[model samples]
Each structure stands twice: as structure tokens, then as C-alpha cells.
Target: MVDHMIILLRSISAFVILLIITRFLGKQTLSNMNFHEFVTAVILGAIAANFAFNEKMQVIHLLISLAVFTFTSYLLSIIIVKNRKFRMWTEGTPTILIEGGKILEDNLKKNHLTLDTLNQMLRQKDIFDYSEIEYALLEINGKISVMKKKEYHNVTLKDLKKGSKDLGNFPIELIMDGQLLEGNLKVNNIPPEWVMDKLTARGKQLDDVFYAVKGSNGQLYIDFYNDKITHPIDIE
Candidate 1:
């Protein structure tokens, strides 16, 4: 019972220390989580776990270890923010995965990514066809930033003149994962009958749709569960 109380106290101390240290590190460390931050997190977690469970270890020694790691990480983060060269060396540079609609095979191999994984990431950005991408960069945070060709670019307000329909507004979600958001339709003054009519015109039913939205241009867009891509690129 005495040992259990000591363990409980140690666990609480570890949690409190971790929370304080992480909070001081700032949200960027939590959000972006570059290579250094990732390492720091893993090491911190290991130390905290040991501090919590290893009853034989001295509390002062564990606390010192935590403090040293946190201070070094925090200092390095400051240096990284101020020094561009240091930041590049630590976090690495963005790799161009796709350029001029051409996939960089060598770059993919260097990054240890397969063609299948690249395709899946592209699909997540609603880009099934790589030909539409002018440039695709793999960011340091493991996100792919894509720029589509000029011909395939979305029309912006700058491209339009005065008295145009509201193109500034984003598309409103009407259906998601085959579930209709009736509240959205009611708020937008859209009738359920109108939605059914549009679906019927497209030879689709609610059960068949994976997602549906009302575009800012007053057009109904529907995506079905079955992608129906006859020739899928399956180069794993």
C-alpha cells in the first residue's frame, strides 16, 4: 500500500511535469512536429514513463534529465527559428515529388515512398490524375502541397468582373458519408425535394452517394462510393 502511494505520486508528478514542459514548448512543436520535435517527444515520453514506474530511480535524477532535455529542445527550437541554414539542416528541405506533371521516381525512392502511397496522398487532395499537377512538393511536416496547372486551376474573384455571383463563398456540405445533413439544407433554404431531384437526374440515390455538396456557383456536386476508375495505377 505504501509502494502503491509512492507510485501514484510519481505518476502524477510525471504527468504534471510533461504537461508544463509541452505547454512551454509552444503549439508549433505540437502541430508541425519536425524531426527534432519528434525525437524530443519520444525521449520525453520514455523519461516520463521511467520516472513514473521506476520506483528505485532517484526523483531528482529523473527531474534533471527531463529539465535538460526540455531546455535543450527549447534552445534548439529558438536557434532553428532564427537560423535558416540550421533549420534546413535539422528539419531537412522540401523535396519536389512532382514537377511539370512528371513524377520524380528517384526522389520517391530517396524518401522511401511507393507509387501507391503517392497516389493515395494525391487522391486525398482530390487529385486522381497526376497530369493535373504542375508541382507537388513533399513538405518537411510530411504533407504534400500541390499546385495544379493553369488550365485546371479554380476560378478566383480576381478573374471575374463586377456583379458576378458570389464565388467567394465555399461549397456547403449537404451530404457526408451517405448521411444527409438536413439542418444544413434547412439553413441554406434548400428543399429536400430539390436535392432528391438533382440526385435522381444524375441517376443516383442517397445510398449511392459518398459525398454531396452545393457549390458556391449554385451547382450540385455529388460523388458516388464506387469511383468507377476503369484503369487504376497500381504500382506499389
Candidate 2:
């Protein structure tokens, strides 16, 4: 029982410490981590795991290791941002896989990517035909960036000679998850009474709403907590 309690306490402490370190590293450490950042994360996680479960490992030693790794990663991030040559060497340059609607077989071979995998990646970006792509780059993070041919690109308002005013505005959330967003309503010049009246008209109360947004098109979109549809279409 004593051993179990010690393990539990250690696990909780390690979890909290790791959480603080991750938050200090910022959102990019999790969301947009490059190659080195990913490796650092894996190593930190392994150290934290050992601290949590390894009876032989000292908590103070693990903490020191975590601190050292985090500091090194933080220092590298600063260097990467300030030094161009180091950044290029660390992250590497993007490889051009396709240019002028022609696939570069040599680049694909060098990257160890198969034609089937390339096609799969292209399909994910909604491009089925390789001929439609003007340029496709294999990014350093292993994601593909595609540029469609001029003829295949979607027509924009500018292309049709439409002015900025013609483009519609986005919706702003006034309430989310049963909580009133007074700041959003104030930004859009909407009164609380007006929102209340709209909800009442729809046989709903503010507490019954899961989400409520006001679109620039003068539409109040309200989603109820108990909304139901008998025959829902499957998007996937």
C-alpha cells in the first residue's frame, strides 16, 4: 500500500511538472513542432514516464534532466529564430516534388516517398489529377503544399472585379456552452434583451442554447443542447 501511494503521488507530480513545462514552451511545441521539437518532446515524455513509474529513479534527478532538456530546447528555439543559417541547417529546405505540372521522380526517390503515397497525399488536398498541379512542395515537417494550375484555381471575388464590400463577413459567437459572451455582443452592438427575445421566439432560453452566433448577414444562428434530426446525412 505504501509503494502504491508513493507511485501515485510521483505520477501526479510528474504530470503537473510536464504540463507546466509544455505550457511554458508554448502552443507551437505541440501544434507546429518541427523535426527537432518532436524529438525533444518524445525525450521529455520518456523522462517524465520514468519519473512516474521507475522506483529506482530519484525524483530530483528526473526533475533536473527535465529542466536541462527544456532549457536546451528553449535556447535552440531562440537560436533558430535569430540565426538564418542554423535554422536552415536544422529544419532543412522544402523539396520541390512537382513543378510546371511535371512530377520529379528523382526528388521522390531521394525523399524515399512512393508514387502511391504521393498520390494519396495529393488526394487528401483534393487534387486527383497530377496535371492540375503547377507546383507541389514536400515541406520540412513532412506535409505537402500544393499550388493548382491557373485554370484549375477557384475564381475569387477579385477575379470577377468585385470590391471588398461584396465579400461577406464572418459570424461571431455570442454564447458558447451555456455561457453568455457579453464581450462579443458588445463588439457587434447587440443588446442582451435582443438575444433573449430571439431565443424566446424560438421556444428556447439562454441556458438551453449550446452555441449562438450572429452572422454579418443579419442571421442569428442558435444551436440548442437538445437538437435532434431523425435522418442525419453522413458527411464522411
Candidate 3:
């Protein structure tokens, strides 16, 4: 086996190099690898794969190459962020694949996309047909995001003139795994005698219960192990 210390140092160096390189490449590089970036990434991965264990492939060379790639990506991002024209040239804006129920065939073909794929995505999003879509945009990362006209949107309680109901507060567990929770019982203003009396009246032993959670509505749910069944009980 290789020395654990050397392996750890190499791993740490690899991680640092990856972090620097990733930051330099900008968010777009990780989001969707464009054609040229994709090929460059494949080559980089191939080169880095062998460097992990090869005795000749020094860590310094790995760091240098990674730094160079990272710097190139960082500089490009700065230019793209500062210059609108350059940004538009380097990173194309989102295209409206379908607008007002009409599909833009030209943009679709340009992006090497098909109506079948678009329809598949639409259906996955619960949209039955293209007519139901008001706008469908081909985002920069090549993902299709669809928006439906307000009329076709799902209905809410407000739309039906019936407001939503309130969901009550969180439940508290007063008894769990056959153990009495003194703090919880005290916090909820219930005496220990009340719990003991309730269980005794129901002909159930305190230790017989597997778990129990209490609600603000004054209802106590008790569960027992299936193997320990065959018992008589009574409760309010």
C-alpha cells in the first residue's frame, strides 16, 4: 500500500487545484459544457487521470496547468460581465423557442433541437400540448423552460374565492419508546398522575407502549409493538 501521508497530501493538492480551476472557468463551464469547452474538458480529464498516481507527473505541473486554465476562464468571465457587447457575442442570450403558441423552427434547428424533445419536456412538466404554453425559452445551458398563460395556470384557493386553511402548531412527544418525558409533560401542563391514571384506566401498562406523540388538540396517539399484541383497552 502507498504511504497514507503522501496520498493525503496529493489529494489535498488535487482538491485545491480543482477549486481554483473551477472558479476560473466561471459558472457556465460547470453548468453546461459548450462544444469547445466540452472538448477541452475531456482532454483535461484525460491528462489529469494519469497524473494521480504516476511518479513522473509532479504535483507542480498539475497546479500550473490547472492555474492556466482557471486564469483563462476568470479573465473571460470578467470581460463578459463588464462588456455587454462582448458578453452577447461570447455567450448567446436565451432564445424564445415558442412564443404565443408558435414554435420558432429556425431557432430550434439552429440549436439542434427537435419538436419531439420539446414535447417530451413539456409533458414531463405536466403540460399536455404546445398550445398550452405561452412562452418556451431555450436557456443558455440548452434547457427548455416553459411558461403557461395565466388562464391555463393551475387554480389556487384564492382563485376559487375559498381561502386556505390554517395548519396547526407542531406536535409534542410526551411519551416516546415506552419512556415518560417529564419535561414535555410538565411543559404541556399535564400532571404525571393524569398520564399514569389514563394508562391504568385503559388497562395498559406504561412500559407496554412503544411510542406516543401528543397533539395540541388533546388527542394522544399510542403505538405498541406488533409482537406484544393481544391486549384489552379503553380510552376517552
Candidate 1 per-residue lDDT over residues 88-141, each given as its tens digit: 799998888998899999999999999999999999999999788878889999
Residue ranges of candidate 2 with Cα displaced over 4 Å: 162-236
Query: Residue-wise lDDT of candidate 2 within 52-121, one digit each (tens)?
Result: 8998988789989999999999899988876656887998877889987899999999999999999999
- Each prediction's number of clashing residue pairs: 0, 0, 0
Which clashing pairs does model 3 show?
Answer: none
Winner by lDDT between candidate 3 and candidate 1: 1
Against the true structure, candidate 2 reaches a TM-score of 0.67
Q: Candidate 3: which stretches are off by over 4 Å?
A: 1-12, 23-44, 53-58, 155-236
- All models: lDDT? 0.86, 0.84, 0.69
**Per-residue C-alpha lDDT of model 3 across residues 9-82, encoded as one tens digit per residue:** 67666656566666657666787765446655665665455455555687677767766655665676677556
- Backbone clash pairs in model 1 (N, Cα, C under 3 Å; residues 3+ apart or in different chains), count: 0
Candidate number achieving the greatest lDDT relative to the actual structure: 1
TM-score of 3: 0.54
Q: Which 10 residues in a row give candidate 2 its minimum summed lDDT?
A: 162-171
TM-score of each: 0.67, 0.67, 0.54
